[model samples]
Target chain A: MNPFKTIFGTSAVAAAALVAFGLTAAAPSAQAAEKTSFKLAWSIYVGWMPWGWAADNGIVDKWADKYGIDIEVVQFNDYIESINQYTAGAFDGVTATQMDTLGIPSVGGVDSTALLIGDFSNGNDALILKDGDSVEDVLGRDVHLVELSVSHYLLARALATLGKSERDVTVVNTSDADMIAAYQTDDVTAVVTWNPLVAEILSMPNATKVFDSSDIPGEIIDLTVVNSETLADNPAFGKALAGTWYETMGIMMSDTEAGRAARAAMGKASGTDLAGYDMQIASTKMFFDPAEAAAFGASEDLKTTMESVRTFLFDHGLLGDGAPSADVVGIEFADGTVMGDESNVNLRFTTRYMDMAADGAL
Target chain B: MTRLVNRHPDRPTRLLLAMLPFALLIAAYAIGSDMRLAENPNDKLLPSFTALGDAITRMAFTPDKRTGDYLLWVDTVASLTRIAGGVAIATVFGLLVGVSVGLLPYARATLGGFLSAVAMIPPLAILPILFILFGLGELSKFVLVFAGIGPFIARDIAMRVAELPTEQIVKAQTLGASTWQICTRVVLPQMWPRLMDSVRLSLGAAWLFLIAAEAVASQDGLGYRIFLVRRYLAMDVILPYVAWITLLAFSFDWLLRVLQARLFPWFAPEGASR
Candidate 1:
């Protein structure tokens, strides 16, 4: 017998045994059978603090037990990459902006549905310019941003507001994390990005917010988008996951000591303290109450937002040639039935779960 | 003398013929770009040619400074700088390790075997550990490139050293030559050709490592550019960078060959077969 092969075989067996032992040791609690696990992907941001909070506290597990399913949340540092990975089938669900849901997964032909309306950028996402320049001054100047992202959409909206076309300025495709560094280097004259990068860049001497997501209001909404197949085959999993989100939100908005502790834990997990986390949550305009989300779900606002996003995605070359209108992106109920007219384009929301939760039916 | 150097009268014609396909491809692409056949609207071809013609014209005349959409040139230069830096470090470290291990048998027995084992380990497997140790900077990239090329060069040179003709060493010893004299005068002279060969081979490996290292936790460089383009689904930017990287790699390989031919002319005789 070859000595090298013998040693290699022994090491492989040892490694396998160690991995098996670790997995068995970490096997979920006795109530694991009552719950089915669902994976959630999120980008690192202050607006996403509730996700960490839910996982750190027993809120996710409690909600799963209530709905008879398991929930697991994974975080990604890059928002676009997380969406892309979700589209590529790495995760069951991902947090994404409305524009990305239309442009990325919907365009890529992956059937996806918005499981939860997370938040909309209020003042968190912005276009910062050097001091002494108005929004009008930005016209015909190069604008740097993560092209085809929510920030890019904000820039386009800003340009339109100034009676300018996209061609009026050069749009450099710079990432949100690198926008601050690029601004510091004097390589770009203007940058559009989201916080905490926006916050960091605003600290520079000449930097000031010339435009922000508030201009577009609900157009830049964020959602927890789930794979259509996962929702269809595992409706219980989807309900459990949504329940976990509501539970986490309850803790976040509560004024109790445990709630504060939960917020602190979430802050630490997300690399921020309680006050800093609160500032981020406020800037994001998050919906912290399940009742509020249920009310929002029944409104015409979300429909209008999805319609505008679908058209924007088409113009940005994200949608495929002669593709079906955005209505087919799977906004269906737990019973796997379509919600409304295919031509409505704006009605990309399923209010069934939210209505049930609000009425104490779940 | 001109006639003697030009013995292969058809060399120029052959070189032109070899470049014809590339030239035609560039022309076709340029014309396609001018005609708006190149999917991207930001296409920049010459003013006279349609979109396709402009693409051909732009392809012929390399863009230096930023023009219409010529910021790609800056990206290309940045990528080339990273590749050059990585290759330079790899060559220096590889040569040092290769020469030291080749000269010392006990060193070869320990360090050479260890390096060979390390060379077999995939770079991706070690990237996370390196990230923790080096903190995602140029130092991490340099370390990965050094590790990747050093072991290969060391082991190759060790094998070459073991294969050195015993007769040469014996002859040197019979002449009352000291160990240092044998190494400097006899061994090094004979080793130069093989060392140069090792460098040529290691350069390709080093270039690969440079790109791979740049792919992880890098804000700038060719690999980062490739990664960012993929995220936005911008295949147009991806293609041009791919072309630039291919051309750069080809140029480096040619440069190394020219250097080898010039520095070690004795390896090929004057009257050798044409």
Candidate 2:
């Protein structure tokens, strides 16, 4: 017999006995089978810092306690691995991008709902050229990037704007950890990556930003997404996440001393100083105000933006094999409209929770 | 300490003993997998054998739709080629330096401590330097594996040569052997089995450097494929690839043992365990 089986069996029986005793000893609650625990995963990024900040400052616990639940926020070093773990059902929710949320989980047959559109990349993801003036100047140069990531998406978009396809330049698939050192070499002249690496590269002499995600606003969106089934089963999870986000965002974006301290904590969490984090947050078009985020979520602008994102994902074969069309995955907007295959829609943009937060109902 | 010696077990008993731990590990995994899947059928952490089999079939038998290549075979070929190339070069160079520093007093005094220091430096610390100096290509990966294990191999060989009996050198000298003959005919013959042993031990470190280099930057390799699928939580693929790597390494180790035993039978004592 496995050792874990023996231990887990005894403990499981003991826990079940304790739960039965507690239920009989206490009064019945309003709702039956209410889940009071969940796990949320987040990685280091400009927009997603609020999750870590809220967890560290007891804001997550505060919001979770309001709904009589416990929320544990986990941090992942690698961006893609967090999403993978979420898709594997190891996490109840995760901070992901519009592109990754579609390309990975949705394509992998895990239905996820975009509960909150945290922010979009204004100039966060950029294309930098060494000794080059414009994007067109990178015609024959080799481009280094974390392939199949948003940087790759940004590179394709930049190339399209330059009237050149991927064939125009050689792409060197590099890891994010090595991108900085790879660029330090004279051989790597062109690189498409996200900040703060972009900030670090730009600090070098003669480096120019040829293009950035800001050129196409509302395209690169960061979101806090949860499993569709998990959310539908427990509406409190969505409420707790939204409440925690807005509360943290409000404090971090304020002009108060407390806000500065909050921002400093966030900066330190992301391995940067206060000024560096402030600059990154400035580049990131964060939806700090709940009302603005609610309006943005409900607006038709979101639908149009997702249409472009879905098109990009499908065009790049990220929607999985035999997609038939760009509508391989259904995307629900805030206005009760669905794009792609409606019956099989997976990427949902729901504003009910955010709207409630904005209306001060939470 | 009390000497605890036992007679060698019979063939069947020895075989059972060898297979016991592996059998227990497999059984433990099978039970754990069943329990996890029973709780959650969608669990990807501990995939069932069928899932791993399916992943292996997909990677090894089928061609990827996008790339139109058998990824498992391609990765194996690429990884083996790099390991073979790196190990081959390291063996030749390690043997030369080891013999030179072992035989000549001047060479030993000048380079012995230097090579020891080189062996102490962590190879992964200089991975960025390798990439910067050699670019993110096969050359960088090859150089990383070579540099990572070469010093250790040389040091091991030098230690073996230093421990050689002084009587052998005196005998060779009294036989009117030239300095070159004394080094080659007398010393080189004795270092062959030891060199093979050093190479076998260094294979582990060589693989470590190869995987580190490949994981940092590479378009194709077993390490690259493992990391690429890791982003999807494809433990089915990752686990099977890991098993495959273990099998490949084991095969190489067994082959080297066989070669050593066949070519240098005199190195072993009769009725003694390996």
Candidate 3:
């Protein structure tokens, strides 16, 4: 064969192959219809473990299949990072606390809705005093806790119980990883922290649980928050999530062998044994019954709880720099009462899916 | 010295060359940030200059509403104090150990291999153990930076000692110099410059360990501030903090270079160039 002919033919073949490869690579987006698949991010917490358990136990799959959609469950080692991922649109939804959802996503400009009220911290978070029987003993001492966290909120509320404020004691910003270590130090006599850490610290002989989240119930609420635009586009996603959550809740609430097994699995996943997990669960007021959760969501008490949370967040400057007041991010409740700026509603608490779960409509 | 592309630029040209990359980086970031903001004004990953400027003013200039601390200055002072204290301890101990390891056969036999092994252990991996052992005070953070950086400095000094010409030691000995005389006059004098060079090389790692320790368990630090704001996707604050850290690191490296040049004008380590 002539050299020119062979060279030209080979080059032409290579170009065609490249074009074909390009077309194959570009085909997926060209045929992209409405997204049927979604990702849900969850982190390790006593309140959020059900989302993981549901995914692992095929509960997530069953519901997703029923709705003719695919749901992928992702676990983040960090609680805040999970919400950040959801805010960044890397995930469609996430397990988050009410204040966190409002402070981060709502104020940061991601319109989100609390899809399910997973649980509220009952005694999961606590303020403990070393060698002191009363919360008053923490007076004039530097209180160690993760600053601007729910522990800080608990401390503020705990202090309020004593008819005092943060001014009574200096709040030293210790990290969660170092909380136990800080407590072990002689100088560190008081600390405000959450469960697992609470469990560990309370195990020490002199440590007394002076106050906890239970003292202010429904204030530290955990929720499965979903992107509002995504939910509006795919109501099936909402139904599927509600189904998955309530189903998991039923089994988890039961004292049957299977329920115990699921609980044990969840405990193991969260780096604890059965008894250890149960202790944490004892501190968490899990909304096992959808009707109760829905009623709580619709109640006027929720608006009051949110008001306290928003005020706490705003006072701490956890809200974005642009926030002129606590009302920078609007939080609409099930009764249509907005807690913040009504013109810019971002975090909405709707009981629709919870109601459907209660009525067995999903 | 034997490599390809050996053409050297003058000092002003070198300075201009160094500035080019930074200028290009800033331009590229501005463009990307503008494009993202044009699409969505609420985008956080690359915030606009105005947002960053506002964040800087709030963090650096204004007193915090609750605490009344200038956030940036406090964080910087905290971080710098820890790093300076840690590195200072590292330097003194490093000089003593490195000289011994380099000059004494016993020190070489005892500590040379052990130090090499210690340096091999990843500092960040044992951070929890450090916190637990040191009890989460400033001591733990200091010890972490020391543990991370100490062994490497010692090893470098030891090697520099070994590299000392035998003739110089013998010459001093021939002149009836004592064992201490060779170390004080010949060995240590040479090692001082090398010690500075070794420290210059390790400052990057020193910063890494310092930042990691701070990130893990600090009340206030540059790294702590960066990590704390990360939860909110506060890129405006985070980016400025990062740039400030970079500036601090570069200043330290530059200061060491100036110090070395001023103190040892007659000396130049191998591979020293523009």
Candidate 4:
């Protein structure tokens, strides 16, 4: 018999094949009619490690079970691509820095809400100098970093301490992947980068951390942001995500063997050992307690940090062509405080989920 | 009766025919851009032509506010210099070593397996090693391009050199030509076209290594610019840069083709078996 005979001559076989594929495809949707499923995207970072831990240790599953929903965590090798995926609706939520959350997704016109304020960079990001000790010494020097990224923003903020600006020093746009290698060269005198590259460079001889995110506290905040439309439709998603995060944060910050084991695992995942991961954690001001995060989200300091971020973004032309001023994209904080144009609020820093987590309502 | 095999296109018609595919591609892209824009005016996936034009103008024409450099020209010059340096060094090294290995039995016994082993070691895998050894500078980028494509060029030249008629070498020796004279005078001239053609074939890999190296650790280059704007999802800038790179690569390939034909008119590239 010819192989094409069965395929071309019989509608019966075709119908059976169609039924098989259709049933398989429809099986999940049938079960999901009452229940729900969501995907969360995360990348490697000290603050973002909890997402990995929660997903691996079944904490995410536990919360999803409690809420009668399904949650899957996805990891991306590239940080920006993770956020891009979340913005393009591939994932319901993503781990991102405050500026990146505002710059790419919010400014790109994706309405997103911060489900949880995970942490802020303390000394996680640094401006390292090969020979110098002060930010003033960066004068007439090429500071290598990824251009238009948070590192560039950190450089700007660092230089501002000495009453200088980005123009005072030349920025040699280098990738984070090559940050440690580039610094080994005699030509690269200064570098602005985040951990674990910061940790790697600091371990090297003659590398001095001149300035870091600690100086400008709360500016480089990290959070898990969810699509506004998704969260609005399914409040269970926001609750489960926030609950899972704080629970994982509790374990990560604890002194138990489980906590130590979790850290070790995260260290291994991020291509480091326990001590190196701890070093990164020391520079990261993670919000293990939901109460502290809520307060931070509600504080006037959040608004101030956002203003600087928006201004920096506008200066870099990241606000898109429709934005005439920095005030075009609205940012809404907790307690009814809205920054920028209230008519178009794309990024909302809501403390509601964190408050619920704190009050044990979640 | 003559059919498709016998259909020979005239030179003018062939030139016009090449424009059709490009026209079709442009039309398809325009339609995609229009449909996407109609759905969402702020879509970055497929930007409108006006936005792309503005991005190109900004990059190529306007002096950057901070550095005060014409960015596109600077990037082009920097990338071109690295490629030229890498290819030139590889060419000289390839010719000398390839000629020796092809002609001398001692040279073949010593370097033949070594060359093949080196070629098998993926250049990208050793990129980190290159950075560590040479430091992350232009030299590392150049060496990466060399390591990636140098072996390919060398092996081809060696094969071509080996395939050279034994009669020519015997006749040269019979006419009182020394081994060195036979290599430089007879084999060298015949393989020049082959050398250029191999380099032309290896340009894609050369560009890959150059872009990868630049993307990793350069201040100013086409790759650096594209990656720098990627964080912002600036597809308008990225697509144009990609198009510019393709245009540059195509021009290089075209020039090599023209040069091969002009300089070695008797060499038949069409008869190349591999």
Candidate 5:
């Protein structure tokens, strides 16, 4: 026997594969029946904080119980990995950005529904140069960023405004965890990243924020997207999650001490102090009111955002294997209008749940 | 009722036994993959071997759109070069310190404990410090691999030399051999094969540090590729890269074993006595 295999008993390799496969074999038909329990995955971000806080504070439980279902909110360390896990069917729902919602999961062929638009990154994502007076100084230089992330998207947009393409500069793929330390080096003069790393980097001497996501508002949006199949089978899961979210959103956006405490707890949970978390929250254009979220969900602006996102993702080759055109994946908006290839609609932006919340129907 | 058999297994039997575990592992993986794909055809984790094979062909055969370079081959060459450079530097430095410490009692007394202490200091713990001092360029990764195995090599050599028969030294001295002559002629020759063996043992550790350093920060390497695709749950790409690393490590070990056997005909491999 191989000593490594003997020692580890396959180390959950065989078991994990079997379990995942077994679940998949039964998932489609099994999900058609009622599901009493479901898992939702979230990551550490200012806009996504309410999910964790709501889960911890029993707010998710309260809302879930109201619908006679159990909702478990799980946290992921890496943002993109959480969406990947959702795409893998490990989670029923996940928190994602507009780009990732269209790019990673949709491109991966997992049908998803945008249940909630929590916030838009106004000045949240930025480009910082150590010594450059303008973003154009990045020409012929290597810009460090987490490649394929919103940071990469922001960098591409920033370069476009200057009439420069990705060919103008080299992209050095760096992790968000190491970006700050990398920026301190003389070798790395320019970096494109998102908060709270963006906030921390800009605090450094001579670090200039030459570009931000605020330039194109409503383009970089954070969303709560659930598996369309799961939502179709268990509508209560959507109602439960939306109800819990807006309830927590109300507390988070309020000026009362209860609200402040909730925000502080969320900040601590995300490994940042209240002040730091508050700074990130400020840069986030949060849609606290369900009426506003419902309106945003049903707006023409979302279609435009999706169009731009598809173009950016397609141009970057992030739209998956052999993606012949930008219309490879169809996006169904809230008003039943489908954009792109209608037969292959993978992304659905539903306003019914949000409109219900706005009407206090939940 | 039973036929008489040879006490030792023949070459075919030995080879069969050697391959059985790997064959079983492959079977287990295939069955697991089949089950997963049956459930969800788009399952990324625990990808079928066919998926892995497809990913390998894509990465190795096709050029990336942006760079127009075959990334797998580029990554392999980059990783191999870094490890080779780091290991070569380590071998020279390790041999010099190990031999000096072993030959001279004063040198051993002063530096022996210090080298032991250095070996105990986990190289990974000081990775951030190395990055801070050396910058995030190739130097940091090189230093990581060098620091990871150099001390262990030195300590092992020191121990091997200390355990050598004292009579050899006395015989050389009785022949009116100078201290330098005794050290250079008697010690260095015998220590060479052992050094090669030590290097074979350190290759595993050297790869560990190299990959960790690369995974944390690098433009191009096998570790970088694995981590970069990890966000997408591209296990098809990752598992193949892991196998490739294992193959490389195994090949290096086999080469060293052959070199040791060819150069030192009298050296007994472990379990040969039984």
Candidate 6:
């Protein structure tokens, strides 16, 4: 009848059951078994259009079916909140920028892998200034953005280009949706942000594009990140997802009527029409071809990019305590090949699935 | 000398007294800024003076474009209405429960203790459960504030009733008065002043809970506006609304005090005279 005794008795029975069953309770029996169900979270953004396309066209389900699993996609109005939910174990996967993937999951001790590289910002992200003001004019002026985010990184890079340290300018933390309104109030002199906010701000009479992501292309990569344990237990899940993504990309990029129709549907789901969506895509510098992504996966450039990103994140006090080596960002393909720092081992990405897609056996 | 001190000042003396501090401070500031008021008066003093003047102008005159006047008036009315609703509910429940428990010793021991225990639990701790049942709406906010103050008021009234002088009730009974008449005429009137005290205490408690409730989920109230401004880091908007809320709290307290004095003049005649 003692309270402590009752509590311990109940917990002991539960722990015994758990220990008897072992951890991988619901894993599939064979390679061709029915696919597991999953939910993915993402915020509204042009770069994230492909996720909607995959969902509407049955590409995500088809890939899941091929992999023997079911998948559900959920949308959030706030990107950081979506990432937060993912970190809190609310979703199996999340579509977020690379910086968020590192900051939210990698830092929060959730071993996550980048399953797919959606796109990198080209001209979509920018630092806008009033007319007649050069980048030098922005020196010592406050630059507003969502601090500790990709926009902040872009601002730092832009400032570095002008031979000015980040110390030269004050950075104000402002949400993307409110950044335009803040700029309108003249509370701050400059804003570093992404579209459609960037597009809206540029339409203002005195607003001018002082610099954009074009100068530092491929730095702001959008990715589909998944938990490490999920991938480890079900390797085929990764392969199936990548295989379906490549197939969907082929449909989207083809010159066929079906491809155009798919793209238009994708645009609609993303809150933009086809032409507007295309403009966003053009600025995003997306890798439409699977072969190119696979080649990029094999190249040394990704390693260099990740190394620099990790170092920059650490230097800016964005990374958590006890600096993680650059190697933690590395991706090891299923085959013998590896990219990025070897010592920096966190579940970042496994090129194994990309290799399978490249070989046409997925 | 005392009569002279109270005498009305002539125009020159009044002007001199008014202008003395102003002239001295300006002279000191001008000297501190290393500018001669005679020669470079227009340029040197203009910017600093304009900044101060602009601030004063803003405070005295609410801009039509900002819509501050409409917002200020609406927020004031909304907060007052919420407090009134809470107080009205608390008064009815507090009086009924208090009188019942106070009259019965058995009820005092069981129900009075339970109500006091309930009052000890903070309302915020139960907000999520309330939200789940009542939903994220005005009803939830009302329930939260009601729950916060209702039990305290009830228990206080109950305790006050139990401790009331029994001699008066016995005297009324000896005069051949009916139980109902004795209760209504003697007991109720005597409890009024104490009930007002309970109400005054409950109003402050209710306002605290009301602001907390509004801060979480309600859409248009002052707390919600403050939270929205906080999300955008709009310090200007936040500061003005904060000032409005402070003014509102002060005004409501004053209104309650005035209502008490006007309705129950005998409660504090000496205090009012001073």
Per-residue accuracy of model 3 over B9-40 as CA lDDT, tens digit each: 56886686567556545655666666556544
Who is ahead in lDDT, 3 or 6? Answer: 3
Deviation (Å) of B249 in candidate 1: 3.9
| Total colliding residue pairs, candidate 2 | 1
All DockQ scores: 0.04, 0.28, 0.23, 0.27, 0.38, 0.02
Quickly count the clashes in candidate 6.
9
Off-target runs (Cα >4 Å) in candidate 6 are A1-35, A322-344, B1-274
- List residue ranges in candidate 3 displaced over 4 A: A1-33, B1-20, B269-274
Superposition TM-score, candidate 3 onto the true structure: 0.90
Report, in order, each candidate's fnat: 0.01, 0.30, 0.25, 0.39, 0.27, 0.00
Scanning candidate 5 chain B in windows of ten residues, the lowest lDDT window is B1-10
Model 5 misplaced stretches (Cα beyond 4 Å) = A1-32, B1-9, B48-50, B269-274
CAPRI-style class, candidate 6: incorrect
TM-score preference between candidates 1 and 3, better one: 3
Error of 2 at A238 (Å): 2.6
Off by over 4 Å in 1: A1-35, A321-348, B1-225, B232-274
Candidate 1 lDDT by residue in tens digits, B165-270: 8898889999999978988887777767677678778777777887777654454576666775466544444565677778777777777667767888887556
lDDT of 1 by residue, A313-339 (tens): 666545543346444444443333443
What's model 5's interface RMSD, roughly to a tenth of an angstrom?
5.1
- Evaluated on chain B only, what are the TM-scores of all the candidate structures, in order? 0.73, 0.95, 0.93, 0.94, 0.94, 0.70
- Better by TM-score, candidate 4 or 1: 4
Q: Which candidate is the best by TM-score?
A: 5
TM-score of 5: 0.91
| lDDT for each candidate structure | 0.65, 0.82, 0.84, 0.84, 0.85, 0.67
Instruction: Report how far residue A121 has shifted in candidate 6, in Å.
Output: 0.9
lDDT order of candidates, top first = 5, 3, 4, 2, 6, 1
Error of 5 at B184 (Å): 2.2
Predicted candidate 4 versus true structure: per-residue lDDT over B91-170, tens digit per residue: 88888888888888899999999998888999877666787788777898899999988887888888889999899999
TM-score of each: 0.61, 0.87, 0.90, 0.89, 0.91, 0.54
Q: Give the alpha carbon lDDT tens digit for every residue of A185-287 in model 4.
A: 7778999999889878888999898899999988999989988877887899999998898888888788899889989999999999788888888888888
